[model samples]
Target: MRITDLNPHGGIGANSLFVELGPFKVLVDAGMSPKHEGNEAIPRLDLIDREPLDLILLTHCHLDHLGAMPVALRNHPNVPLVMTPASRVIAQRMLHNSHNVMVRQREENGVRDYPLYRRQEIEQMTGRIFPLAPDNPRFFSSLDGDTMTLTYHHAGHIPGAAGFTLEYHHRKIFFTGDVLFDDMQTLPGATFPREQVDTLVLETTRGASGRPPGYSRDKEVGQLVQAIRETLEGGGSVLLPTFALGRMQEVFSIIHRSMGQRQLPRVPVFASGLGVDLCDYFDQIARKTKAVDFRRQILKDLKVQRLPHGYKPGQRLPGPAIYVLSSGMMVEHTPSYIAAVNLLGDARNLVAFVGYCDPDTPGGLLQQAAEGEYFLFEVLDKRAMLAARRMRFDLSGHADRDELLAFALDLEPRAVVLTHGDPEARDWFADQLRTARPKMQILDPTPLEPVEV
Candidate 1:
């Protein structure tokens, strides 16, 4: 088997892999880099010459894993695109939302090549997506008369996220696409097959951070609740800048349960951006799959208020409430960025971050700023005083470093390839794995580089 990393940059975003086994050539994912713009955001598909892929396997509906599916499909229109049922629903909405964003950018930001793929193209691609039930093995015959089988295991990062197993010629290969072993507020952790494989493609998102010292998921949630209660008691609002997909749904579930149990005050909870649509999609998936215990309609039962279309930022809120907005990193022009400007002048208001933020992002800069300091707001081209309370929680969707290492050890694969992590994260995993299994072959290939197994 031969595998190549399609990302132009070796780091996390734009995660795509090309795998060639027997007579079949498969593309694992076609993603876009959130940090880049226009054509630069997409994977290096030019290298593949839009070749006719035997199959395209999508792990989840997250933008970083599924954003560029329409672009890939445009090249290989006949290729069979496969994913979970819930992911199919989510991916369609995500792509449609992304198209709207691109349209707005073209008109507002003066982007020349904004809309990479048209809405009609996205619809065409969506129609070809084939949903595969979890744990069901499907066999196919390759061009060379070789039998190939595929199976999906629940990945547990999001509603329909999955890790896939591919079997061919008496050899098994496993790909752990963005996984989490610990349960989240809305979803249970993943359960992988115990059988060993010859090759393992693993993710290293949190390898550099490792496990938090004396920290657990329950403790993190408790801390968030305490912080919210304190802010609300002080007559201040809380702003949670989260990703519109998995992170948004998870945070909403937590706040809903906390209020029901009276662990948190019954303050009004508001949601905006594409997250609101994603919640609806989550509700649909919950009703269809029963994969999660969504006892009641989350938006209705939790009483989440949707922000109106003409609502202006920094406008006086009715009272102490919780606002969950998108663009987790607080990118320019996003709802969280606008809300932060309005709330930063008030000492009582709090902005809580619940996931990873790159240092170059607006959210990371705000996190680093000290109280009473001035931060330049690039979007508005002005500087503002940092006075709002800031807090970060370890409520990540990725598996802890120790959990990933333990899983790798259990699999005992002949070779391991680490992807979807920064250089420091990959290095940390390499050193730890080398120490644990001295003779094990661990590979971390550069972008566009191919490794044979």
Candidate 2:
């Protein structure tokens, strides 16, 4: 088997991998980088532009893993796309939302090549997605009369995230696509096969930071509740810069349960942007698939007020409430950025981040800024004084470094390839794996570089 990394920056962004297994060629995850814009945001599809692809596998609907799918579908028009039922629903909406964002960027930022794919194109491409039931093995015959079987296991990262296992010529290869071993507020942890495989393709997103001492999901949630309660008691609102997909849902669930248990004050919770629409999709999928133990009317039952479209930044809410907005990193022009400007000047308000933040992003800058420091808001070309309390919780969706290392050692694969992490994260994993399994072969392939197994 031969695998080539299509992501320009190893596995950090635009996570596409070209895998050749005997007579079959497969592409996994065509994504766009959130940190880059225009053509730079997309994977280097040019490397495999001329190669004939047999199939495309999508693990989830997160932008970094499924954003640039239209580009791939446009090139390989006849190739069948495969994903779980929930991902199929989420990807269509996410692609549509992405197109809208790109259009706005073209006009606002004067980006000439923005909106790389049109709405009509996305609609056309989504028609080709084939939903595969979880745990059911599907067989495909290659041109060389080889029978290849594929099975998907729950990944526990998102509603439809999956870790896939490919079997060919009696050899099994497992790909852990953005996995989490611990349960989130809405979904359970991953349920991968315990049996050994010949090869393992693992993601090392959290390898750079080992698990912190005295840290647990419950503890983190309790801390977040305490912070929000303090802010609300002080007559100030709390802004949660949430990712529209999984993180938003998790936060909603957390707040709901906290209020129900009286751990948090019963303040109004407002949700804004595409995340609210995406929640509708989640509600539908949860009812149908039971992938998560969620109420079909959870959003309504929780009494989450949908922020109106015309709501301006810094506009005083009715009372001390929790504002959950999209663009978790607080990218310029996103609601989170706008809300931060309004709330940052208030000492009583609090801004809480529940997920990863790129150091270059507005959220990251805010996290590092002192209380009285001035932060430049690039979109508005203005600077704001920071006074609100800023806090980061250990609400990451990836497995902890030690847990990942233990998982790898248990698998005992002939070879392991680390992907979907920064250089430091990958290096940390490499060193740990070398010490733990002296005989195991660990490889970190560069972009477009193929490694044979």
Best by lDDT: 2
Q: Global lDDT of each model? A: 0.86, 0.87
RMSD of 1: 1.5
Q: In model 1, what is the error at residue 339, expressed in angstroms?
A: 1.0
In model 1, where do residues sit more than 4 Å from their true spots? none
lDDT of 2 by residue, 1-453 (tens): 999999986658889999998888999999998878888888888788888988899999898998899889888888999999888878889998888888998998887878988888888976798899789999988777888999999999888999999999899999999999998889999998878989999999988888679889889988999999999999999999999988888898888888888888888888888888887888888878877655637678778887755877657556588999988999888888887778888888899999989898988888888879888887776777888889998898898988888888888898999899998999998998888888888999888889998
Q: What is candidate 2's CA lDDT for residue 204? A: 91
User: On residues 1-453, what C-alpha lDDT tens digit does candidate 1 reach at each position?
Assistant: 999999998888899999998888899999988888788888988888656688999999888888888888888878899998878778888999888888888898887778989899988876788899789998978776888999999999888999999999889999999998888878999988978999889899998886658989999999999999999999998999999888888888888888889988888888888988777778778889866644337778778887546766556665588989888999888888877777777888999999888898999999998999987777677666877799999888999999898898888888889899999999988898889889888999889988888
